[model samples]
Target chain A: MADAAISVQGARKVYSTPGKPKRTAVSNVSIQVESGTIHGLLGPNGAGKTTTLKMLLGLVRPTGGTFEVLGMDSTRPSGRRRVGFLPEQPYFPVNLTARQAMRFYGSLGGVDAARIPERTTALLARVGLADAERTELSKFSRGMLQRLGIAQALLGDPEVVILDEPASGLDPVGQRDVRNLMLELRDRGVTVLLSSHQLSEVEAVCDQVTILNRGSVAAEGDINALLNVDGRTSVRAMNMAELPPQVVSVAEEIAVSGGMWVFSMPTEQTRAVVDAIDEAGGTIAAITPKRESLDDYFAALLAAHTEDVAS
Target chain B: MMKRIWPIATAVMMDSLRRKVVYVVLGFAALLVLAIPSLPDYGLGVESAVFREVALALSYVTGLVVVLSLAANRVPAELEKRTVYNVLAKGVSRWEYLVGTWLGILGVMAGAIVAFTAIEMVVGYFTYGELMWRLWEGALATWFEMGVVSAFAVAVSSVTGPVVVVTAALAALFIGHSRSTLLGGEGAMALRPFYPSLDAFNVVNPVAHGSGVPLVYMLSMVVVFVGFAGACLSVGVLLLSRRDL
Candidate 1:
């Protein structure tokens, strides 16, 4: 925990209106992100993913919690000096050109005046906005603005970056760029806490994930640990006219297409299945542990939680 | 602290330059100042005094319109657009944000007032054939008063929209200048000193009809400006700190 780059413990946010019932936006949500790793925060709409990030960034006052970054309380300015945040659908002063906006945010991030222009140019080019440096933000497309948001968030070369829906308004290519950027940041030993709805993006880059449902952590921990199906092995074989009878008896899910057979069987049955395929003059193309897709895992987790609430 | 505050302030200043409100208001006020000498009731006996009075009034109105336009909308617009998220998330304290915003509006006001006053000085000089240096004194008072007004508007805007902020600011202005009229009774007079009034910034009598405001009085106006603006901004920071962006 001491080595964690970002730590949020028992975070809570309750909003009260004069004549309405108190609303809880977040409830006892805790997250620990280790240094130099990508941690994905996934949730459906209104699941408090953004709220948790806001609390961590001190943009929203938490009802109760201790948020820390690099062993300092994150709710204070000093603690956030080394952190960078990109809000969901990040907005900037539209009247400013891209270069001017970068200078403004860079200065706020405490970038040295002498280095700001150099850093701004480098960061803008890095985000694929070098050509638009002098273009006013009002003329920027949503995707361009998203890219600029990313550039500004990196102005200080932050040690820990918190991004909420960084790919919200991006195209497929831009989304790919963002995913690769996260990987690059992790490679540079920068910690990332990403709140996103793009499950594929998260699955591709995240080492760990926390799934929030209804303002609570419905599931968390290692991605593989949660998705890998225990005692099951997936097998793919080529040039098989049909699955061997012995293999078919044990294979739970079996399919054959274009002389390629794909099936899942108990891990203990792998040796027998291989032997049958070899005896049947079939090539063993690949054998790996069966795993659930993140999309499926997320849906099932939410469905079970809904059932729990309903019951 | 200045590092963070200065950037936000400069951003607001830069944004103000792009807005048309300042130019429109200043242009209209300049035209009015030019036309003041052509008033139907213009007389030869006290022409300079009358011109000074009307020019100062024009300056005040122009300053009010420009300040209200900027202060009322700056914070609310930023909040609505979520542009403030980037600033605050960069480790800027709420007080710094509010102060920087107010300071920027004040800076614009300073430029406008100086320009407008210089125009009045030129017009007054050509018409009366004497340098109406006293208009600078009026300009100083007007600028100080507008600074206070902008602080109030910026403070209110931290919690509400532009409409509420403008309405509240206008009401504060009326009450500020109407303290004696509103509090007429003996008992009310007892509470006069504690009342938040802006009369200390009013120097029309001295600058328009008599010798220019004394240096001591001008210094006192500075104190009043600082005190009122600081109090209002302190309240704004408190409100913004408690708010969830």
Candidate 2:
């Protein structure tokens, strides 16, 4: 099998709105996800995250470009067979029990009938629905429904799992459980592609992240490398009058509030600012380095894209 | 493809069977079929003629019920509930899904039709002291007619709302039944000069000629209507596959 679970190049999707020119949902967007990694497709609303996922799953045809999944063309049935998907809001037959729904989806995946019962039980237990296995899905809470959606997506042990906003409408505890389950799936060597507006969840779970804006990729790389908040440190002093001019110049922004100097510094000049403060005989009350989160990184990317579009 | 289609169709059948609507429709059909023996007392016609007339009317009513309850709701209900996305993403081809669903609902309607026909036959035998071949023939024609009408209902439900699809299908049924009479009229035939043009309209009408229930003609009409239904359904699947959902 290929090392990349999903690979897209120059993918584009255009929907022709009546009485208007065609609108592009994804434009020349390319993405590559390695096997056994949890990749996050992060973007603001209407940024084409769902469109990209739909194209990858062959749910919608692309206007341009090529993509492959699990060593087969994405448009082919063989490639789709290796994929398990959780739609943003999945529905089950109202009268069907959790067990029955799982069995139905599992059977569609061609799982052996003899093994379905065992697999269904295991999946229900995994999603913390063991007690409600026989309960009708219509009676399930929103959180329980989301968990069941995960359980169904895991049926037949698919090679790649795509979850679109898996944690949306979930409570804090439900979100945490889903995040843990995603990590567990990753650990077990399953490639996962997840899309979410929850930056904290993406930050905590994703190994690689791709930020999109206006139907195009704004930034793509390892989460840690892209979101590194180096050279920025917070400082506290008894008085602001003693701060030096050279230190002030190097500080990207310095705000004095609650008797503390918050310095956003240039990446290469943090050491110089600290030394200058010491040489000037200013006593540093506290110095704490700040780390940029996925939220901040995405915000910066989106802001840059807006500026680019405006110009 | 067949492997994937069979399971989906099985699921559809199982789900439809669990709906209370199916039982209500079946019970009403059976009651109408059983009530035929009492209709001769109205003095509208001979006893056997009245029995056959009432039996045929009962079949049409029950068939309409079957088409409405079992067929019209297949796709619209799924789409409304948002469950269509789950099955569509399972790598099942659109055509397979449509065909499987149609067959599943068809099976349920067929079962109901057979049960109602059997009840009417038993009631006839007990009341009239002889088997009525014409009534049996009418029942067979009704089954075929129902199959064709239900297929059209399914096709309509694929693309339109439940209310519109059912109403349009019922309208089509009325037109199809009266088509021969309309076309045979002197003024109507005179207005359409082109033979081929007239023939085209004739093709859309499913009714055929015979006194004691046109069995062969009814069978052929059902087959042709099913072919039309298949074409409509294929178009529906194509539209659905390209839809944003």
Candidate 3:
């Protein structure tokens, strides 16, 4: 659609080295991320997720297909004027202080020289690096470097941002901060394409996800749609020390903790279970359609994909 | 264009300073230049000329070492460290990155050449009682030649690693300076124009033994620097554009 901020159509990449077999890093992978949304790129180690992102960002050459950001060819400098990227485990020249490094990147991002000082201050503060602004990068910790990478990617307030393993070396708090930052950017109408191995991080902020396996898109869609469990609903009840036998009869995946009973059942039997719980003097805390955790969904998706490839 | 290139160039220059290679080479060469007056085989009334020749040679080697140490590793190290991703991903063209890199190395070489020449001039003043201003011409020639060398290294490094880049760059230097000796045959004379040469930037003969390089020759070296550096960088940008980071 015209509204799609990033469109990768039939994207393919093949790496050729002398005296070795040609390796296909990405094949026929296409994804469309609409404006102002966070799209997660998911895959295993050799699944071409990073390669695809690299091709799109012009960091790697693509053997086939078209990649566009805001309808512009993102592989060119002019088209990338409004885009930003953070490489996996991003590194910078150790000789530069954090502020100077930001200035250098800000200039490359086409930010006004006069505005760089202010923008650098604000962005470093945003990423919690304000205190380390003048510290040379050689002295920065892994977590600090990752924060600086995020700060640099946000310079010039790019319309589109691509992040590869943005949380790779961060502690939990830093990862959370990055997630919050991505959400904040989305709220400001910035499009984000995040490539990450951290499934929980992806599940937390991604509106849509594209999973790759063996150099192709194995699955792609809204996060909820991909993980939703069909024909099932989850029920949570309170105040009853024990679940009534009638509710248990149809319930599956039942768990009791903190004096609350939680279970999933067939969607058709939701009414029967709710009625039974009501009769048993239990408070129906909530009832919602059940969805599988991303971890489980991803594992099964790959397992099924492996089977498909094998057979 | 300048906006992106200048920052990268400055960053390269700043980064180079922290690495001890430049100062170490410069210091060693300066000490050698200071000892140039003591060469015992100077001909009658040609002692200053000999000092100038040895000093000029020291300057050239010092410049090449500084240039090679920086250029040979700058691009490859950046690629290996993934530091270049930050710059290129910020919308700067690959050509800009290469040129900016060369500019930074050139900038450092210029600084080193001047500093080394200044030491030579001071030595010449104390030893022979004349400023020996001709060494500046030699320094300039070395600066331009090393600039071309750095460009070649940067271009080659776009597709390879530091070791290969250094090897290729040194080979280039050898070939660049050997066009006269290696292609002296009538059969090879036809290929002279096609072969890239570092001869234009070689003013050592006049700079070390005579009244120094002419103004016009000095201007032509700039032309040659532009032609050679531009060609090398164009090739580098082309190769880099196709590379996968």
Q: Which candidate is the best by TM-score?
A: 1
The regions of model 2 sitting more than 4 angstroms off are A76-78, A230-290, B41-46, B131-137, B185-222
lDDT of 2 by residue, B108-187 (tens): 76677677767766877787775655555655566656666666777777777888888988787776666456667877
Model 2: residue B243 alpha-carbon error in angstroms: 2.8
User: Where is model 1 more than 4 Å wrong at Cα?
Assistant: none
Ranking by lDDT: 1, 3, 2
Whole-model lDDT, model 2: 0.76
Candidate 1 C-alpha lDDT tens digits along A1-311: 43899999999999998999999999889999999999999999999999998888888999999999998998998889899888899999888999999999999999998999999999999889999999999999999999999999999899999999999999998899999999999999999999999999999999899999889899999898889999999999998788889998999878888888889999998899999999999999999999999999999999999999789
Give the docking tier of candidate 2.
acceptable
Q: Superposing every Cα of model 2 onto the true structure, what RMSD results?
A: 5.5
Worst 10 residues of 3 chain B by lDDT: B30-39
Give lDDT tens digits, candidate 2, residues A111-188. 888888999999899878999999998899888888888888898898899999999778888899899999999999
Better of 1 and 2 by DockQ: 1
RMSD of 3: 1.6
What order do candidates take by DockQ, descending?
1, 3, 2
**Cα-based TM-score, every candidate:** 0.98, 0.83, 0.97
Q: What's the best-to-worst order under TM-score?
A: 1, 3, 2
How big is the positional error of residue B102 in model 1, measured in Å on the Cα after superposition?
Answer: 0.4
Candidate 3 structure quality by residue, lDDT tens digits, A1-311: 43999999999998899999998888789999999999999999999988888888888888999989988998887878898898888999898899989988998888888999999999999999989999999999998999999999999999999999999889998899999999999999999999999999999999999999999999999999888899999999998988889888899998999988899999999889988889989999999889999999999999999999999
- Report lDDT (CA) for all predictions: 0.92, 0.76, 0.90
What fraction of the native interface does candidate 3 get right in terms of contacts?
0.93
Model 3, span B1-245: residue lDDT tens:
99889998998898888888788888888888877787787789888888888888898888888888999888988999999989888878899999999999999888888888999999999998988988888888888999899999999998898899889988999999999899999999999999899999888789777788999999999999999999999999999887778
